[model samples]
Target chain A: MTVIEKVSEHFRVMLGQKKEEHLGTITDLMIKRYALAIGDDNPLYSDREYARKRGYEDIIAPPNMVASIVDWSVGLKEEDLHEDGTPKTGGILPSNIQGIRVMGGGEMKKFINPIVAGTDVYVTTEVIDTHVKEGKKGPIAFLVIKNTFKDAKGKIYCISERTVIAR
Target chain B: MSNTQPLQVVYSEVEIGEELPILKKNTSPLQLFRYSAITWNTHRIHFDKEYALKEGYPNILVHSHLHGAFLTQLCTDWMGDRGELKSLEVNIKRFAIPGETLTCKGTVVEKKMVDGEGLVTIDLKEINEQAEVCAPGRAVIKLPLV
Candidate 1:
């Protein structure tokens, strides 16, 4: 089978599969690091007092934080890692397609609500669809997955549909 | 229970053609490492230069998610204290590396009053120092009617 055909076969089986878990919670240090790493010193994400003055009890996380969820709340065990250093599991996107190149370029995001530090987040991910198309490189497979993040209080912070291209 | 936007932008005062102040940030190897660290991303292309070269990259590649962070900075910084970012859609058009300067700029495309909040839409772009478009996107922002 061609690479795309093999990958597509795998993706079709995974479609509609849903994984639900308490992925992780936002934290002050994590928020600050994320902000500084992006070189954004916006007080909204870094200073508690500034956030309080703005009527927030604590610092807020960058809006995109939910979409970048990288680990379980506790920690990522060694077994969860791939040889290349990327997390091997948890994401709805298909993994371990030998001889196929996969690239995640960007996202289609909807920030339903702002996320704050210290919020316990739960996530539900489902593989929504998959399709194949010819590209400049070769036949490209677009795997689309939807992720929804809700706080412990049941407030939805963000929902995203990300596209991962595998060729 | 609702947080106002970061900017004190009055809904009626904003015009469709208004441009948000450009948000620019410089990238380097260290900052990229920090981003990857915080996100638990261990993609070798972001940290291992030699491996990146073998993968045919000139240097370590900046995380695609980092581009999302840069775009997020542009909106939150521009909205200031009273504008809420209701939604944002960013799609990367190219890969950017460290030592490149990425700038986020957006133009107001539509404005309206919906559900008692002033909502505006923007067409956004993240461009590298070389004048190449790296990511292009759109956002929906809610502003205070007051």
Candidate 2:
């Protein structure tokens, strides 16, 4: 089978598999750096004492913090990557889509609780669906990856889905 | 320090069909890198040209959420401190990469007094340097009419 065909068949098996990803912890420095990087000067995200005055226990990560956590937790370990040192998808996604370039489509995300520093989170990923459409280049495949985050106790925190296209 | 803008706008004075002050911000690779760092995004397409080319893109791509955040800022700046966003939905039509200046604009489309609460509909769009609508979105907000 061609590379694309092989990837497609592997995706079929991943349709409902529950993929586990352990995100270590949320750090204050990372949160501060992120807020600074975005040029957001909101005291709620950068100032701990100020944040407490505003009713938060401490500095909170921005709303899109989940995006970064996914990238870090999903990629293969550095030692297991390709010889070229390029990041590989591993079986995190379908094998057929091992090489397609995927972009972050917008997500419908809800912030259930504030993500404070030193919180260990776990994410469960699932392939929600896959479809093929004819594109200008030829045929393109669209895969939806849904990731659900939960605290150590298994209480759900947030859910996000990314739509990726493979050409 | 309290991050205060020059002026605060209350939702009461905003009229239906009115246009908010538009902002045109220029973006670059450095800015995108800072954003990626802040978001902890290492997609490679946002920073690595070689990786992007391998993925069929001519250059680095911007995160879809960044586009939405820009629009959200536009609305929040317009609402100032008194209004709260109820819902926001953005549909990505095209990609806006680094080195492209994007203009974010919005219009107050509908306004009504619903059961003692003031509601507003704002139509928002982000246009790239090429004048293409990269992300078209809408927001519903609850405002207090002065």
Candidate 3:
């Protein structure tokens, strides 16, 4: 079977499958580094006093911070990584599809609450849908995944739906 | 230290069709590398130009999430302390490489008073140096009523 067909078939079976993970605690340094990396000067992500003045309990994470983090666990050994440098596991796709190139197509996010610095974050990822589309070069596969971030108490921080393209 | 004060946007003062202050970004290879490291993204296309070319891109590509970050900053900076972002959606239409200038802009589209809170919808977009639309997005924010 062709690669696109193979990937799509695999993703189709994963539809509705969900996996929950402990993403660890949100730290002040993580928040600050992310904001600085994006060149965002918002004091809400840095200064504790400034954030407190704005009603947040402490420094708040950027709205998209949790969703942008690619991995939360300790990384794989270098030899186990894909040729492309991506991890073989911990991703939505199976290891067999490592040869294919994957790209982020887009995302839709709903911010429910501010994620505070000391909050322990957890994520639940579910494969909502999958399909194949014809591109100028060839057929491409699209995987639609939804990620819900919440605290230990199950207080949702945000919900994000992302489209991943495989070619 | 940079100024910690945020712009106080009053709900009653926001007008439909108003334009947001533009936020411009120019990505360099070092910046992309740092972003990748911070996000724990091991994808080579974002940092290795050789690997990126093998994949048919002109150079190392910018993270799609970075585009969203720029747009988020555009909205948050404009809304400041008086408002909170409720939702944001962005679709990547094209690839953006390093050294290209990406401009993020938004236009206020609709406004409503829901449950004693003012909600505003803004259409957002990020354009590349070639004037091509790299990403188109939308954002909804809640503001305190005047």
**For candidate 1, what is the DockQ-based docking class?**
medium
Q: What interface RMSD do all candidates show, one decimal each? A: 4.7, 3.8, 1.6
lDDT by residue (B50-127, candidate 2, tens digit) is 877776678888777778777766776676544656556676889887778888989999988888878888999999
* lDDT: worst 10-residue window of model 2 chain A: A91-100
DockQ of each: 0.53, 0.37, 0.74
Model 1 lDDT at residue A141: 83
lDDT of 1: 0.80
Q: What's the lDDT for all of these models?
A: 0.80, 0.69, 0.90
**lDDT, candidate 1, B42-107, per-residue tens:** 677888888788778899988888888878778777766777888888888888988888889998
Residue A69 of candidate 3: its Cα lDDT? 90
The B-chain TM-score of model 2 reads: 0.88
Clash totals, every prediction: 10, 3, 0
